[model samples]
Every structure is written in C-alpha cells, then in structure tokens.
Target: MNDVTQPVSRTVGILAGMGPAAGVDFVRLFVAACESWLREHGHPVLDQSYPEHWMAQLPVPDRTLALSDASAEQPLDAMARGLRQLASLGATAIAIPCNTAHAWHAALQERVPEVELLHIASETATDVERRGLARVALLATEGTYGAGLYGHAFDALGIQCLLPDQAARKRLMQGIYDGVKAGDLALAQQCFTEVGEQLRAQHGDIALVMACTEIPLALPQAPAARGWTLIDPTAILANALARRAYARA
Candidate 1:
C-alpha cells in the first residue's frame, strides 16, 4: 500500500485528450482546485503551491467508434501507453477526465499497477452520497450511457441514476460532439441549456450528473436557475486529486 502520509511533491499524471477540450478543462479545474485548497488552509499562494502534473494527451482512437465497430483499432493499447508513460515519469496518481475512456479502466490499471487511477464516476457517486442525494440525472455520450459506467457506480452507492430520454440524449450528444468538440461554445451552450431544461422538467428536482466532462464546459448557467444542482464529475475529480496531493501536509 502506498503511504499517502508522505509528501506528494511528485508529479500527477493526467490521462486525457479523449476529445481534447475536456482534457484541457480538467487540468484547468485541477489547477484552480489546488490554488483554492492552499488558500483555504491558510497557505499563501506560491509558485510551487501546486503539484507537478504530467499530461499524456493521447491521440487515442475514437472511443465510441472503437466500441461500436469490431474492426476499429482498440484504444486499449494507446491508453495503456499513456498510463505507462505517466508511471515512468513517477506520477503518484492519475486522473482520466473522459468518462467513455473509463470503460477500459480495469485493463489500464493492470498495465500500470504502481500508480492510482482516479475513477470519475465513482468519485461523483461518492459525492452524491455525501450530499444526501437520492437520485441524479446523467448527461453523457451514448458510449458512456451504453456502458452503464456511471449507472453502475451510483447504483452500488444506493443512488438512483436517471438518464435522459432518447431525444434528450441526442441533444446532449450534439452538445458534446458537434458543439464542444467542434469548438463552437455558443452552440454547445445552447444545446446544453435546452437539454438541461428538458431533463429538469422531466425529472422534477433531480440533480444532474455531468458525466460527460465537456458538458460542464458548455453549460450556460448553473442549475441554481432551476433550483437544482448540477453535479460536475470533472470538478469533483480535480478537487479530490488536490486533497490527495496535499492531505499529508
């Protein structure tokens, strides 16, 4: 077992670039969280306030295509290589921002057992439990939904995971792929807010799980507008990483 009590001055690995934008957003959140953690604990902001992070922005094959098509190149090898690269750089822990990529998490862990890989969905589910939330809505790619990655994790924690309807799911996908991935923030915001409204109306006070990392980036307004909370897995994962990196100090 790793002694987390030791100083975590070592590098943290970010297994990212599944879609590129989401990966960048995740790292930005991590940086912000580190700054916030230091300030909240009465530590003045300094140049070395944050841990060194190695970003392995793998040009891995498309996760959805790889999952749906039998002949498509599997992303397993590329993802494994990224994890191994991080371990080679002596990363104490790793964070994969993409939810769809998490489908290969177990195999990736097997390839790099020395470091810890943070599970975004599991961390989000844990947050839901801590907040005493019974049910939450999922807004993610079709690949993530089909894999039941978030659903299974939330279920194990006695939380009900609500999914968008077919039409709503399609809208969410448009926001992720055509909007955010394509670098059209305006369109992404439009699609995200519209779909969020639909989900909020249908579910009636249910919190939303931004299972797709890009969703949070594209959100137009916080759920406070609807008197509900939108759970951001990326933010949760980043904050968790910050805490783990500084816990011993």
Candidate 2:
C-alpha cells in the first residue's frame, strides 16, 4: 500500500467594501492568481486545489472623507472590527483592496499582528522596480496622495513619482467619488482618460499607476490611454497574497 500526504491549505482574508465593486474585482483577481499559483506548483487546477479564503465586505466609513476632514466620520474603528472578525475566523493572511483605506494600515496591522497584512503600495513598488522603470504617474484619491502611500514606497527605490497638477487632481477625485463610487462608469472613463492624457502630454509616454482600485475599471480601455503602460496595484497585491498563502512550510 502507498501512503499519501494531503496538501495543506491556508486561509486568506479580504477586508474590503470601501466600495463594493472594487472588492468584487479583487476577488476575481485573487482567484485568477490562485489558478496561476496552482499551475506553477505543478498541481491540477481543481476547485480543491485552491486555498481557503474569506471576504468580509463590511460597510466602513469613507476613507477619503476621514482623511481629508477632521470632522468627518472615521474608518478606524469599523476597519478594526472587521480585522478582528477575520482574525478570529482563522485568516492567517489578509489583503485590503481599497488603496485609500491603507492610510489606516499601520493601526490595522497593530491590531492583527499575527496575521500577514499585505501592503498594496509595497507590492506595486516591487513590481515597478522589477520592470526596471524609473518614472511613473500615479492616479489615486486625494486621501492616498495626502498620505503619501506610493510616494513613500517608490522613494526608497529612487523612482520619480509624477502626480497630476491641482486641477487634474480635482478631476481625478471627481472621477472617483462621482463616477465609480456613484455607479457612473461613463463619467469615470471621461475623467480618468482626461487625466491620463494630461499627464502623458506633460511627461510623455510614462507608465500610469492605477493606485486606486476603482481607476482600472474605467481607465484600462479608454482610447486616450493608448501607448501607456498601466500598473495595477490591486493585481500586484493579489499576486503577493497568493504567494504568501501558498508558501511551502
């Protein structure tokens, strides 16, 4: 008789719902990543081959509003509650798909110190560095910019992080709040394309970092976005999460 050993499974948690659409998108990306990981490990792509994962799509306060105004509702307590719930459920690795929500990452990490909380900006920065690109344009919410999430990560690699001018930044914000979050993807397409064009015209054919999870939904196929490389932080983060969840003991 031959002895057989079962493959070990690890749990990955997704703390999402800063906006429902982005959370759903992250799950799709994560599943695709898991399939890729299975193939790389020489395993058949079966449903049982996938890792155990849980998604807590809770309604947290607006991250941008919380960051921009002191009087606005804060997201920390709500976010902390979600993290505790996931941890209690045996999630050993976690990913937060919302970029703006990362402004509270430190506090959240402190809350769940035992879990591996993936950092989207750090993953994106590592991807960018691996591609050997030295300059990239960032498109994100005002809150992400204010927190210097990508900027701090890219700075360590000596990458030049280009940002939109004030007016263009406002346009980006309008696209995020009124367009994607409000279920108006057409408006988001327009706003994001214009900003991409403006940045490309100013900097000339550089890569555009879709730092906000919502930006990729509207910007990827825009005609004006032709001839530019789009760096998707969410996708990079998903890949990172897969690598962590599937690591050999």
Candidate 3:
C-alpha cells in the first residue's frame, strides 16, 4: 500500500467526444507531447513514465442545439457527470478540447469547483499575447461564434479576434459538417484552405486560430509559409495538461 501523505500522481481527465474524431485526436496529441517532453528532460521516454490520464468520451447532448434551442436539453448536467466521473477516478485536472462546449464553462466549473477545468480560450488568448499577436482570425462553429466565448477571452487580453463574415462562416460550416465530419478529408482540406486564403488576403499578417477541434484535423500544420500562423487550441490545451501532469516540485 502507498502512503496517503506521499505526493499524489497527477492525472488529467479529457472530456471529449463532441465529434468523436477530435476527442481521439486530442488524446493522441497529448500522449505525443508527453513523450516529447519526457525525452527532452532526460526522463525515461517509456509509456509507463508518461502521465496518467483518462479520456471520458461522453455521449452528451449536442452543445449547438442546447445553445440555440431553448427547449433542447442542456449539456450542463451531462458534462458535470463526466467531470464527476473523472474526479471519482482520481483525476486532478480536467481539460475539454471543444471550444463550443466551453459556453457552459462557468456553470461547469461551478458544479465541479473542486476539480481544475482548464480553459482553452483563455490559454489560447494568453498564447496570442505571449506571441505579440494583435490580430488573429477565428475559425469555429456557429454555436461558438454566437456564444462569443473566444471573443470575450481575446478582448480581455486586448487581442483582436477576426471572425468569418456570414458567407465565409457558411463555407466553414459546410467544410466542417459536410467535409470533415462526413469523412471527406480532401473536401474539408480544400474548403479550409480556401477560407484561410481569403481570410489572409482580407486581413494581412493575421494568424488563424483553429478554435474548432475539427479544424485542426483538416487544416495544414505547415501553412506558416502561406502568410498565416495556424494555432491549434488542442495543442495548446494538451501541452498545458502535460505541464500540470508532469510538473516537478
């Protein structure tokens, strides 16, 4: 038996499955980051040395519907239950890779105040500030756009968030729903690239924030040469979780 007073091992709980694919992708990215971090620090880069984590792929009600329809079942209770499950399993911190789901962040945290809920928007906004990026384009779902979650975070940090106009937003929605979500990677990539190009042309020197978890799956990671920095919120959140999980006293 282990000593109760000994420092507890850090365990990160991943609340995912909003689209299923993004959830799985977030886990893979996190494990890769952990491996990279372990190797760089001269630690054993074996799987056993990596941080303990639980990916709770809950089948919660649709967040977009909950936000848009007044009568639709809210995801708050379901999300809270997922967090409680993680806490019950000894997870110290929780990370949700979905930006749209963060609309209920305040209420979710209120329900599970004992557990740490990492904010993706706030973290990404901080990165924007750190990189001295004054303006950046946002590519996200209609629910996220309506919630203004990213807007509030960026505004708080004095960073300008550029969003898609109505027509562009429609194209983005089709790319995500008809292309990425529908398992047509090629179509999705083409649509995303076109939107990015237009956004870049309209707003020069602006970085593109793949605020939607699905966008990262379709968007090219090496688009820096195209005059736009692609920021993946999943990467940002994953790295943060790794830090908290592997932090040395």
TM-score of each: 0.91, 0.96, 0.91
Could you say which candidate leads in lDDT? 2
Note the Cα lDDT for every prediction shown.
0.83, 0.90, 0.85
lDDT of 2 by residue, 67-96 (tens): 989899899999889988888888888999
Each prediction's RMSD to truth: 3.7, 1.9, 3.1
Question: Candidate 3: misplaced stretches above 4 Å?
Answer: 1-8, 221-227
Best by TM-score: 2
Error of 1 at 221 (Å): 4.3
lDDT of 3 by residue, 66-173 (tens): 889979988888899999999888887899988899999999999898888999999899988999989899998888999998999999999989997888888887
Cα deviation at 2, candidate 2, in Å, is 14
Query: What stretches of model 2 exceed 4 Å from their correct place?
Result: 1-7
Worst 10 residues of 1 by lDDT: 1-10
Model 2 has how many clashing residue pairs?
0
lDDT of 1 by residue, 1-249 (tens): 433432345578899997788888888999899888877877667765678788878798988777778699899999998888888987878999898988888888888889988898889999999999998888889889988899899999999888888988888888888888898878788888887788878878778888888888868353433555778899999998877677653
